[model samples]
Target: MANQKLKRWLKVAGQLIIAVLAIRFVVKEIDLNELKTTLLSANFWWLILALAAFLASKFLSAFRLNFFFRALGLKLNDWFNLKLYLLGMLYNQFLPGGIGGDGYKVYLLNKWYGTPLKQLIGATLLDRVSGVVALGFLACGLAIFGHTATALGAFSFILWLGLIFAFPAYYLLVHLLFKRFKSVSHTTNLQALGVQGLQVISAFLILKSLGVENANIDYLTLFLITSVAATLPISLPGGIGVRELVMVKGAGYLLIDQTSATALATLFFIISLFSALGGLPFLRLSQPKD
Candidate 1:
């Protein structure tokens, strides 16, 4: 127990150090005044729309996870599951050094429903994998259909191939490792697209809010790439610095304005923070009917 606790603290400390270094690098690279101006000049209505879209995406995400839960025979009410999801989000963002949101959910559900821990863990793991798969599919599609392909020159054909086979590949993965979820794989994957699509729309709205009228696809492509980086469990709470670093670096590569890209990343993080806070009120776990 002592060793595990020490390991957790070490992980958290390492994450904090990396986050600080990344933030410092990003700050040194970008024009702080330009970033401030970009943020301060954002359109208020468009930002509101972006927030709404982000929240909607999160709701779709909760629904997608619930589909996996039901497949495991742990039938939870939609409202109950959503509340649980919000609470989990809160735990994940705020308590990264301890048992994460997914860990807590697995413990609570197993305790409450007498479900097998292994099955619950698998369901949770698969839920996350589904989201990653969707992110990959959309990122690949955007790379092919947008300016990224043109920029990649000879390598653009790789994006085409990935877009064509992404889902089939995901299906095969589920068949081999998570056969129980195979029944709902198609539905969950489709819903995953909806979730990611809304998130992309949110990102686009953020760009629009910042008055980025040209090179929209380039900015969005960077946003998607940065998003994948942020999802990794290496950054500070809320992925504060890692997202900015990726956006700054990716913007330089994509020939986008670093200041505007940074502002967009900051705004999206704010929206995500607000959405995560929705779980605050649902933190007290309640026993749901079986």
Candidate 2:
């Protein structure tokens, strides 16, 4: 028990350090005054739309997870599942060294519904994997359509091929390993696309809020890439630093204005933070009896 606790502590500490260093790197790369100006001048209406899109993405994400749950015979109602999902988000953002939002959900579901733990875990794991696969697919597709292909030359063809095969490969993996989830694979995958698509739209809105009227493809591509980066375990709660660092570097490579890129990342983070707070009210609520 002591060893496990120590390991968790060390992991959190390391993540915190990485998050700080990454933010520092981003701060050094961009002009702070320019970033501040951009942020302060952001259009409130666009920001509100971005927040709505982000919330919609979360709603779709909760619905997608429920599909996996239904596959396991849980059949949780959408409203209840959404509340649980938001609570999980809160735990995920605030409890890095704990059971985590997913683990907590698994524990609760097992206790309440008596589902097989293995299947519950598989459902959760597959839910995350499906999202990641979608993120990769979209990122690769964007790279092909954006300047990344031209920059990569020969390697761009590999990206194109990956984009074509990603879903098929994901389907095969599910059939082989997560047989129980195979039934809903198609539905969940489509939902994953919608979830990510809305997120990209949210990012685009954030850019518009920052007064970026053009070069949207590059910025959106970078947003997707940074999103993947933020998923790395080393990132802090809310993916604080990793996303910013990736945006700064990606902007430099793509010749985007670093200040605007930083502002966009920061705004997206803020919007996500705001959305996650929706789970706060459910935090102390009793587990649903239904």
Candidate 3:
């Protein structure tokens, strides 16, 4: 028990340290007053749309996760599943060393449904892999067909080659993971795509909110790339500083202005951070009685 408490304390300390470092790096690397001005002048209506899109994206993600749970013969109701999903999001952002959001869901499902623990783990792993696959696919598509694709010239062709190869690769992966649940593959893939689509729209709205006019695709592409980076698990909550740093350094590739890029990244992070907070209330309550 002492060791467990020590581990929890260590994890919380690590989370705070990483968050502080990330915030400091972002502040040093970007113009604080400029960011403040951008926020002050932001189009609130556009930000509202961005937040809605972000929330919708989470809903779509939760919906996709249901496919995995059902594949394991677990029959959680959709509303209950969403509640579990939100709680998991809370655990993910707040309790990294403990039973994480995913582990929490697995634990609850195992306790309630009496499924094999190994199968629960596999289902969760496949769900995560599916989301990453979707994110990578969209990032590649932006590189190949987004407005900046022309600027990429022959490099676009290389991206296209990668995009073409991605399909078969994804199919092989699904085949391996879904040999028995083959029918769920198509639905899962579409749900994953929808989840990313919502997020891309959210990013675009965030750019618009920050007053980015033309070359919107440039910023959008960078946002997509940042989304990919956030999945790397090497940074603080939601890849805070890491994501802002990615935009500051990578936006130039798409001819985006560093200041606006930083603003967009910051706003999106703020919006997402708020959205994640929605799950906090769920943490205070007991599981809903089915």
Candidate 2, 80-113: lDDT as tens digits: 9999999998888777632398898998889888
Instruction: Find the 10 residues in a row with the least total lDDT in model 3.
Output: 90-99
Q: Evaluated with TM-score, which candidate comes out highest?
A: 2
Tens digit of lDDT per residue, candidate 1, span 149-249? 87788988888787888888889989999999999999999998899899999999999999889988888878887887777878776677999999898
Question: Any runs in candidate 3 off by more than 4 Å, and if so which?
Answer: 1-25, 97-99, 146-156, 284-290
Query: Each model's TM-score, in the order given?
Result: 0.95, 0.96, 0.87
lDDT scores for all predictions?
0.87, 0.87, 0.78
lDDT string, candidate 3, 1-290, tens digits: 99989987787677567757766777787788987898889999999999999999999899888888888788778888888888888777665532378898888778777898888887887787777777777777777656557767767776676667765677797687657556687898899889889998998888888767777767777887787777665566676677787888776567777788888888887887788777876775455576
- At residue 11, what lDDT does model 2 achieve? 97
Candidate with the larger TM-score of 1 and 3? 1
Model 2 residue pairs with clashes: none
- Model 2 residue runs over 4 Å out of place are 97-99
**How displaced is residue 86 in candidate 3, in Å?**
1.0
All predictions: root-mean-square deviation over Cα? 1.6, 1.4, 3.0
